[model samples]
Structure formats: structure tokens, C-alpha cells
Target: LHNMRTIQHLPREKQMQKATETMELYAPLAHRFGLFSIKSELEDLCFKVIDPNSYKFIARKLREKKEAREAFIEEFMDPIDEELGKQGFTFEMKGRPKHIYSIFRKMQRQQKPFEEIYDLFAIRIILEEPHTKEDCWRVYSIITDWYTPIPKRFRDFISVPKANGYQSLHTTVITKKGRKVEVQIRTRHMDDIAEKGVAAHWKYKEGKEGGSETLEKFVHWVRDVLDNPRPDAATEFVKDFQLNLYQDEIYVFTPDGELRTLPQGATPIDFAFDIHSEIGERAIAAKVNGKMAPLRQKLDIGDQVEIITGNKINLNPDWINDVVTHKAKSRIRQYIKQKERQKAEEGREIWEKRAKRANIEISEQDLTRIAQKLKFDSTQDLFYDIGKGSFDVNELYDVVKQFTSKGRIDDKEDEDKPAPVTEEEIQETYINAARSISDDKALVINGELTNVKYSYANCCNPIPGDDVMGFISRTGDVKVHRSNCKNIHHLIQTDGERIVDVSWAKNIDSKFLGAVKVIGEDRVGMINDITDVLSKSLETNMKSINVSSDSGMFEGILTVYVDDIDHLGRIINKLQKVGGVKSVFRYE
Candidate 1:
């Protein structure tokens, strides 16, 4: 009933509402089905009522200048028509102009004014008796032979149709009068297929609809995205699915010249996965046009892509960040999860190795308890971190060494390490054990003070995993400095006796503070932009920020937690990339 109201042409407001429905719902549906022509038309129709002035002006001008437009079309068609006629090729010609919405969209994307936009019109040619692949190439030859074709503007969609199964031979040429225009050539069947898309298949008498399972799967996916109950959910899904749907497809061959369709930005990874899931899982690298290319390389039309596979597992977790397609991302994530599971099993082996190396006897149950204390959901997640370089292996060794080295365990008695009698005794004992009595300021490591001790240094606060050294004060208190700190060498030289060995504690939960200074052009919303960059873009929790502006420059000092130097670098790099940010550097 609602669909019928949309087509019945009711009141102006009703028409507007219907168009909106089409834009929000059907346009995306069309895109999901790879029906670019339908999607574009729906967008154009919605824009007509949404912005009536632009629509009216564009339509009125095109019609008001109808004779001129048709004359131009006639001229555009004359040479191609004459050439095809000489070659005894039968075809029909049609002129098409840019709709208002498409022009507006182009204007918005290019950030250009309308007057600068040319080629707001195009022409299409439909050839007959071009059912075979050879016939399509023959048509291509006939068209190129007659006209001075623009190499960049030519598109051979007949061989590689748009995602929606639309096919054509598209080219652009400059007329004798020097007016630039686009020309699209296709067969009558191809034109019909272009217009109605999958619906066009329904129009055919043959069983075209049941022929390809891939096509049926694509259509079903499109309907699923559209039929989702929540409007917002449908809208979100469409945005992702639409990119794949509306893009012009490339027909690339395998090494054996078998054709495959990939979207414009599709890399070799996309191509590999399209071929087979296992093949994609094993893909290590790719060859494009018979030369090695990065997996992220943009594939051109008719460019062959060959994926290189390896027997050894080598899936990079970072591949998840680069893939544009959901399929590729999902597959990479699956591989990462599998790798993580394997790592979790390996973490046990690693822990056992550490125990043997230190001549200590500990079981997996003890590691599990420690892992739970650290709030890890699984021993695998913890071990995966150890395997993936997120967790330091040496720190695990040091921590285990410290705890096990001077244990008062009675070697003759094995009672599974009895628990403390009370919670307070556990806390008190933990605190006393954390601090050394002889130094009263040093934290003992492996039963020795080692030369390093722990105290929060005034210069560049250090964390558990931070590379650091201890500076012993005159009062016998330890002061820790980052190992790279410039003040450390001078302090050690002056007070060598005060220097001690220090390492990050294994189970430390203390937060270390760091600051970033952002300098940018002072403008309205500048502060908001900076705050958004920190909070939203960088995902840093801003405890306190102080901003000062002078001479068209904005400076902000942000205090945020530092997991380590790498985390700090990631935040700084993100801030540096923000618009209008002149510089983002560590303040202190």
C-alpha cells in the first residue's frame, strides 16, 4: 500500500515524502543490489523535491534550450552513427544530460561551483546483434575507429558491467565545436538490463533469474539490508553495502584468463577472498599486471590480479585496519582469533620454559590465577599478548623470578601454597613485600636490590613497562627516571652511591601522566575541534586541559595516561593529523 502511494502521485508534500522514502530506503536498496542507475535516479528524484530550486533551474534550462541540446546531441551522434552505418552495424542513439542531484553531488564532492562543472550531459548508443563476446569487441572497434576517443573517459563496461549487472561501452570525445561530452554505447538487451537491472531479468522470457547463484545471493543480501526492521539499522547497513553495490566493476583475469569482478578500490586481497576463503586465508602477497603490488593497491579496469599463497601461516593482525570490504575484514579477524587461540596454548609452553630456565616449579593454575588478577578474560588473551609483543616476555621472566627466587616454600612440603589467613594480612604482607627493609625505599627484585629502585621521578613520570633507572637521593630515597632521560646521566655522575637497579613491577596498576601541546590557528570552534581530536579521534581520556591562545595560535596541554612510549606516540600522531593543527608535540 505504501509503495502504491509512492507511485500514484498524490499531493506535493506526499510526493516529497515518497521521494524521501525512496532516497532513504529504495536508493540504498538499489545500491545494495548493484543497481547504480536506479540508485542514481532515486537520488536525483529525491533531490528534486528536497531542493526544488536547483531541480527547476536544471530542468527548465535543459528544456528551454531543447533545440540547442538536441542539435548538440545530433552532432554528437552523427560521426558515431555514420561510422557504425558504414560498418553495417545497426544501433539506436540517445542523448542524456546530467540531472540536478548528480551535479550538486559532484559540486559538493569536488568543492567546486556549478559554473566550473562541464559535461553535464552525455549520449548513449545501443548496438544490435552483439550477444557474443566477440560482437562487443567489434562494437568497441567500430566506435573508436570513427571518433577521437579520450583515453581516460573510455569505459568498457560491456566486458565488466557495473556491480548491478549494467553493461555498456562508454567513451567521451570533444566535438568539432570543442564542447566536451560523454558517449555510452551498448546493445538493446544491455540497455534494458541497465535500466531495470535485476528486474529486467524478470522481464526476459528465458530463465535468466535462476541461472546464477552468485547473482541470486547478491540480490538476497540487498533485500536483507533493506528489510531490516530498524530504519537507522537499515541506513547504516546500506552505507557499507552501497559502496560495493554502486561501484563500476573491473573484469580482471586470473593467470589462466578467467574473469572476476572487483570494485574500483578492490585490492588483491579482495580478489583472493572472492576466489576462495582458504585461498584468501593463505594469501601472503599479490601480483598485479604481472608485477608485485601492495595488497592495498587500487585495481584498474581489466587489470589482472594474482594472489600468492604460502603454506606457513602469516596473517598480520593489522590487515584488519586496511581492508575496505566487510568480507575481508571478517576473514582477517577470524584468522587473528585463530592465531590468538593458538597463542594461548603456546603461552603455557612459554611459561613452562621460563619456569625451567629460572629452575622454579610452577604450574598453569598459578599463571591462571595471576592472569585473573590482571582482569584478563582468558589465559589465551594474556598469552596472545605475550606472543604478539603487546606483553613483554622479559617482564614476565623478571616478575616470575622475583616472586619465586626467595620463596619461603618448604621444599619437603607441598600444600599447594596455602592462602593468607585474613584479607588485611594479605594486603599488609603484599605492601611490606613490595618495599625493601634494608633500603626502606628500594623494591627488591630476585632477592637483590640490583642497583635499581622505584620512586616516582619528577621528570617524565615512568610506568611499570617503562625503560627506567633508579636515582638514590641523599636521604636514601630512590628517584626513578626514564632510562632515556637526559638528567639521569648527570644525576648518576654527581650522586653515584644513590643510584640503584629498578624494573617495572609485574602487577602494578598505577597510572603515569604525560602531556601534549597542540598549536593551531585560533578560530571559532578551535577548542572544540582540539577536544574532539583528543577525546574522539585519539580516544584519550582528558583529565585536565588548559588552553591558551595568542597571535592566531592555539596551545593546549593535555594530561593523559601513558601505557608506554608507543601509546604516547599514537596519541601525538593522531593529534598532529588533525586539521589546522600546526604541531602536536610532547610538552613535558
Candidate 2:
């Protein structure tokens, strides 16, 4: 694919597509397999096809300065070549040209044009086998001794090969001509691997006893990428492949000093998953370099990491954004999907129970009818919506009634019906219906009343701070209501003696369910921001939160557990300040 991209006579669109494919596949594959030379060539070829003018301009300048560059290289290598000869070191010297892609990158990164880029060419010293390792270092010392080496630009890869298994000694020094030049010293074996990578490893390992295990690991990882079952295989494979190709690897140590390698920008969560599946799932936080760190904290090379786990796994939906590894993302998504399945099953059960209470037997036909009435694509979708609180139970009940009734009602007549009864009126009807049953039970005043059973009116959902009253039903049980409840006057007019003064206990510790309604302009991340605010408040337990949006406008209802009116008010006040919220008020 990479070579195909460089065919200039091909259509520009076809060439670009080939370039993209090469970037998505071959470039990363080359990098992973330790073929730095091939990877650099592939990148430069793609750059040339993508932007021919810039590549031509850069190439032209480098060609124009070819003579001067050769002269500089000769001047830089002369003293080192002579010193190595005097020291009886057998070595081969070569000039390494910097790839156009690398030069282009330097131009962009340093915000400089071609004229400002130093080290466009480098010198490599390849030593013979008899004293390969020692001679490589000896040559490095001789070169640095003859010139002033740049301390920061020095890299001792011979001691620590790169993650891709390229080993060399690299240094940048000022030559006699005051020009900066890069020098790479390595053995013939290392040079072969650095140039041809995994291919060379296999090609040259005929009689070698223990072959490159690092290269073996790289090959295994590539196999895994090919074998994994991804959700969207082509797109996901391309994305992950590109990530592997372009990112640098960071090596961090486990508590036991076992080194773990991860891509640059990988978080501790990725590290934990890389260690073990269970460790990643149950990870609550992390300790990086002996200090507590967030799960999303990016790791650095040589840092020690210790994963912190708890009894329960913290597989939050937000974890997908924090993790960069395919394994972690796959696990988190699977867990979330399983949880959704469970919730949908639970919602189905709730619907079944409601159907039984209404004396309606639900069959597949009934479910299909209800699903159509709700405008849902399928019965499963309807159940899932119910589970997520996006569908109302009362509306579902009405749908069931229509299906079970003796006669089909005319839709136009239903549309023309009078306004629906207020919640207060519905509660009044319930109280009136209970007037015929007589009982001797007294109302419980915050556990003060014994041998008595009472219930709260759903209309008001009154809490500790509200003025309260109790109504004695014919069944003799008491029903509590807010003193200012809309039906209070009617109840007093019909059965004044039934009304009794009621108060919450002075030190009640119980929580009451409160509802708040919010109106806002719909925008991305609004729900996340709202939930973040609610989660931060102490003792705030969200029972249900439902939001609906239409044409950029949104309305939401949040039901929560609160201590009293005051606690509910505090929640409302906090919600009112959230961005995009137009109004936040208690719902009666």
C-alpha cells in the first residue's frame, strides 16, 4: 500500500486513498516490527504524494547543498576514522541521509524551514563481530572526545534498546566547522535489525540459540490485533492500528519491579488492564511513583505504578474516555451492555406486575399493540425505555386499557375529551373511595403512634418542614396530607372531624422522596454536568432522572431522597446554577 501511494501518475484521489490505507496499516506495522528505516521511508513517500510541492522544495534545497553536506561529513568522520584505525578497531563507516519525512516533521515541530534544520545527514559506525559491543562504545568515546558533545542530545540506546528492539549509541556533537552532526554507532547485527527489523531477525537467526524474545513479543501483539473481534472491525482496526503506529511507548514498572510497556498518553487504567483483566475491572485508583494518582493519569517511562482495587469494580460509563487500550474499552462496553440487558429484564417484570394488577393478561399480541401505541420500534425498546425512565407507567397502563376494553374508542373523541384531572383531584377521589371502610388504627407520628398503620398522600409528597394534617378513613387507618394540599378544603367540608393536626417528630432521621423539574436548552454534556453536581452533594440519592429534548429545548425531572424541604431546596438551588439550566423548581 505504501509503495502504491507513491505512484504519481495515478489519479490524485486514488493516490490519497492509498496513502490513507498505508498510514492506517503499513506505517504502524513497520514501526511495531522495528523497521525504523522502512517506516521512515514509508512516511516520506506518503508525504511526497500528499504534498508534492513542499517535498520538492525541501528535496531541491537538500540536493543544492549536497556538496557542502558531503564535505561536512568527511570533516566529521576523519579524526574518528583515524583514531579507530590506530586503536586496531575494524569498522565500516557510512553516511546516513535523513529521511524527507523526518525533515518535514522537524520543519513543522520547530516552526523552521529547511534551511534551519541541522543534522540532515548522519554518520554510522558499524563494528566487526570480534569486539562489536566494546568497539561500538570505544568509537563513541573517541568521537565525543574529538568534538563538544551536546549533553541533552546524547542517547545510550546500546544499554537500553528502544521498545522496537533497535539498539545503537547516538550522539550529537559540534564539528571543527562548527556544524552540528549526528553520529550512530552500532554492531553489524544491531544495524541489520534496525534497518530490516523483524524480517532481519528471522532471516539471520539460522544457528542462534536464543532468538530475539522482544521481537517475538512484537509479532505476537500483531497477531492479536489481527485476531481480536472488534465491534466495527474495519474502522476500529484502522483507528487502533494508527494509534500503535504513531505513538511512542512508555515503560513503567509494577510494584514487584516487572516492567510494563504502554503507548504514549496511555493512562494507569490501561496499565492495570495490560497487567490483568480482573485488576483492571476492579481498579478504583492508582499509586504512581508512591503517590496516589487518578485512574486517568498518564504514565511516564520508568515510573512505578501500583493499582488500587476494591471489592466492587468501578466500571463507570465514563471510564471509556479514560482508557486507551482496546482491552479496557471492550471490557467496559461489555459490562455496560450487560447492565442494560439486566435493567431491561427488570423493566419487563415491572410491566408484567402492573398488567396483573390491572387484571390484564399480556401476550405477544398485547406487547406489539402497546409498542405500536408508544411509537417504539419493538417491544424490547419499549421495555428499555421504561427501565431508563424515559417512558411513563401511567401512559403504559392507558395503552393496556385500550387493548383490553370491550369497545374500540374513537380517536377523535378521545382527542376532544376534557382536560385531564389534576393530581390533587385524583388523590381526593382515592380518599373519598376509602370513606366507606372503617378501622380503629391511629396515624403514626414519626414512630410515636403504636399499633397503627398510615400512608402518605402521593399528591403532595410532604416532608418534615411542611404543615401537615391527617384524615381518618372509613377503614379506620389514617392518611397524611400536606395542610395546604389542594383537596384539604374539600376534605374539611365533607368530614371536618376526620381531619387531625399532625407534625413530624422533632428528631426524625428518615428521608423523603422529592421531585424537581428543570427546564433548559439542550446541549452536549448537559446531563453529565447535572449528574456531576448532584453526585457531589452529601446524602443526595437520585432515584430517577428523566430528560427529554425537542428542537434544542429540554425538560427534565429528577427524583431524589432528601432530609426535608430545606435539603430539597438546597438541591434545587445548586441545580439552578448549572450551565444551560433555565429554571429549577420543586415539582408538586
Give all candidates' CA lDDT scores. Answer: 0.64, 0.74
The number of the candidate with the highest TM-score is 2
In model 1, which residue pairs have backbone atoms overlapping below 3 Å? Answer: 34-164, 451-500, 451-501, 452-500, 452-501, 452-502, 472-498
Q: How high is each candidate's TM-score? A: 0.50, 0.60
Poorest stretch of ten by lDDT in candidate 1: 224-233
Could you give candidate 2's per-residue lDDT for residues 292-379 as a string of tens digits?
Answer: 9988888887889999999987777788887776667767767876787787887788888888888787678757655865678778
Position 52, candidate 2: lDDT = 57
lDDT by residue for model 1 (294-373), tens: 87777876788889999966567887656555456556766666777788677767766776886877556755555654
Which ranges of candidate 1 are over 4 A from the true structure? 1-25, 32-37, 49-53, 78-90, 110-112, 128-147, 202-239, 289-298, 311-313, 334-588
Clashes per candidate, residues 3 or more apart or on different chains: 7, 6
In lDDT terms, which candidate is top?
2
